[model samples]
Target: MSVESTETNPLRALSPQDLRAHAAEALTRARERSVALTSVDDEDLVRQHSKLMSPLVWDLAHIGSQEELWLVRDVGGREALRPDIDDIYDAFQHARADRPALPLLGPEEARKYVREVREKSFDILETVPLQGRRLTEDAFAFGMITQHEQQHDETMLATHQLRKGDPVLHAPAPPSSRSGPLPAEVFVPGGAFTMGTSAEPWALDNERPAHEVAVEAFFIDTAPVTCGAYAEFLDSGGYEDPRWWSERGWAYRSEHGIDAPRFWKREQDGWWRTRFGVYEKVPAAEPVVHVSFHEAEAYAAWAGRRLPTEPEWEKAARFDPATGRSRRFPWGDEEPTPDHANLGQRHLRPAEVGAYPAGVSPLGVHQLIGDVWEWTSSGFEAYPGFAAFPYKEYSEVFFGGDYRILRGGSFGTDAAAIRGTFRNWDHPIRRQIFSGFRCARDARPSEVA
Candidate 1:
């Protein structure tokens, strides 16, 4: 697989060679993730009914099934390699908890299936024209399948985190913060800005048809709230205080006996949390992660602030006051590099807060692109003129107030799949994903100075 430069403008048309290169790289990444799973035994791979995740084998086969559906049948106009297996891998058809009960393909079978589909898919890629129908036009179908596989790779990584075993994955620690003492928050002088992407070629349906949104000036945290800051809230009886939580959040907390972020426990001398299979003292200076939206809200309320609305978050991330245009990323149009942000699983954990000055937004917000997904106040909804793409299950079914939006990507996120315009959503109570948040407040005349 070859490395391609970041599409400075994702909207532009790519040559056939460029599309093929992108497809090859995507397959390489998916294969690498699958190889990582081999470190665990078959028993671990087939384990089912784990909290909030599916059997690893299911994901493995599902990756191949999806590729066959899109690249082989849909794009290539070829017959289904295995029509009977489609029902088994349909994500919407089976819940995660129920997947283990079904007759899932074993590890070896799953590997063979994925390999076969990938071989066929590459053959299709070599011959398929990069123009004509909407799916083939600009090779959207291939790009979509690549992103789907990468997204599942992230899910598989999360499964590794939830699995009970010795650590099988390793990466060097992120660089320490070069930032000195800075203001706790920055004021975003709000105005109208383009909130979504209309031109981004591979952008999903929900992010399509960019529209202008007017926003009120708001004060937002300079960086994600750190573990140290969250610890302060916990020490102040944050979980115990109903005043700090919403009615629903309070009830959920009581029902679950939830106190601190998931995986956290207070040791006799200090706080510690499990990472992969290892336990270590919680790093105070790092951005607090594995938090739910409810926890983030309670922390914001405790601090006399609130979670930024999705628009506010976008403004902070992409708005350039000088150019009056939203850049592809907080830093600029350049693709994410190690120097730009802690992305692509280069590091297993978030770098310290206030790190990655190069990745900071024009408004001085730090670590806005990676480290952890920051929860916002807005719920998932369709943009103006929204239309479902090749399928409705991708984004249409999930549109509603049920899921809160999270911006930025986590350390495990593939850079190819994340952009400033990218939006992630989940139930407010989900804590397993690498999530954290920063506080925001409506800008007041007195506070602006």
Candidate 2:
């Protein structure tokens, strides 16, 4: 295991040659990380580190194995590697960490395997020209795979740190705090906003077949629910009270034994949270992040609030009354700036809510654009007359399922990828991403029924 080039920025435009070179470099690093696993005693490799970190051996194989499956095997190429590769390394398709162990390669041999596959993937990438007919497909596949690996690398780093009993990670600086409430509640006079994307730059199929959506009036929380506020829900026994939960949500909560948010631990002196292996006092004013849809819904119920629907979120964010049109972003058509929202810090962590008040939408909602992803009441379903986008797996797999909509980008979100029209989805119970929620209310007088 050795360090060569540690360049992790794989999203920038690259020539065919550069793309190949970068892929090979990343594969080499993946191998090195894997080889490092071999040096760990078998007992240590198999030990449970933490939920945030997987076993090193599992991570190493999963990274390479997933690349081959998604990019090569799924894309019509034969699986050219070990037949049992999926059995050994598929994290999503398979969850058992203790699959029949392969003849574990010594560090050097494993490195060679990683290097070889990486080279092959790179070589294959070169065949698709930067501006060719297959450009969209190649970009989407490579970009998604690249993103997956990058996330695994971060996870591996966390795993290593946790195994060594390191401290939790905090943001480099505390996010700017806001006192009290917003200046005034933002009322996005609701109307039709075009929902979803039609543009061809690396979007999942589910985000495609762009369509216009009619939304009625609704009032959204000016800021994400703060930790201080959620604390009130907890103090009121929100978790124990079943009336606040949907039947499915109640079941999920019981299955997981969830009480407070996932990372929270009540201590002798109030609440503390663990992040990236370290534990720190939970900041009262920071947005209460990492809460599942179930948890968010439950909290909202207890607080006499409701989650906003997707159109309601967009109306508050991108709608401009003068034009009666939605801008690409909440602030305007211009690209995101730090002052507008929190994003793309190399270290992944969300800023305090309302830190970027200037970026508030026309409706005066703060952090409507970025911070932690805000859960909406809407589900992940296609709009009327939705057709599949080019990337078939992106939207086809999850349509009409239980996944929920999360608007606003997160701290880790790619700047180029975010827009008011962009939509993200996840299972309602999953809360690993930096996610939070804001409250909403029916704005129509007749909604009182």
lDDT of each prediction vs. the true structure?
0.86, 0.66
Clashing pairs in 1: none
- Writing each residue's lDDT as its tens digit, candidate 2 over 256-374 gives 89999877899989889877667788887778888999999998888777999887887787666666655667777566777788864333456676677657676567887666788
- Ten residues in sequence with the least summed lDDT for candidate 2: 1-10
In order of appearance, the predictions have TM-scores of: 0.96, 0.75
Model 2 TM-score relative to the real fold = 0.75
> How many pairs of residues in model 2 come into backbone collision?
4
Which residues of candidate 2, in runs, are more than 4 Å off? Answer: 1-61, 66-92, 96-127, 132-140, 150-164, 168-171, 178-181, 254-256, 333-337, 345-348, 385-394, 416-418, 446-449
Query: Worst ten-residue run, lDDT, model 1?
Result: 1-10
Q: How far is candidate 1 from the true structure (C-alpha RMSD, Å)?
A: 3.4
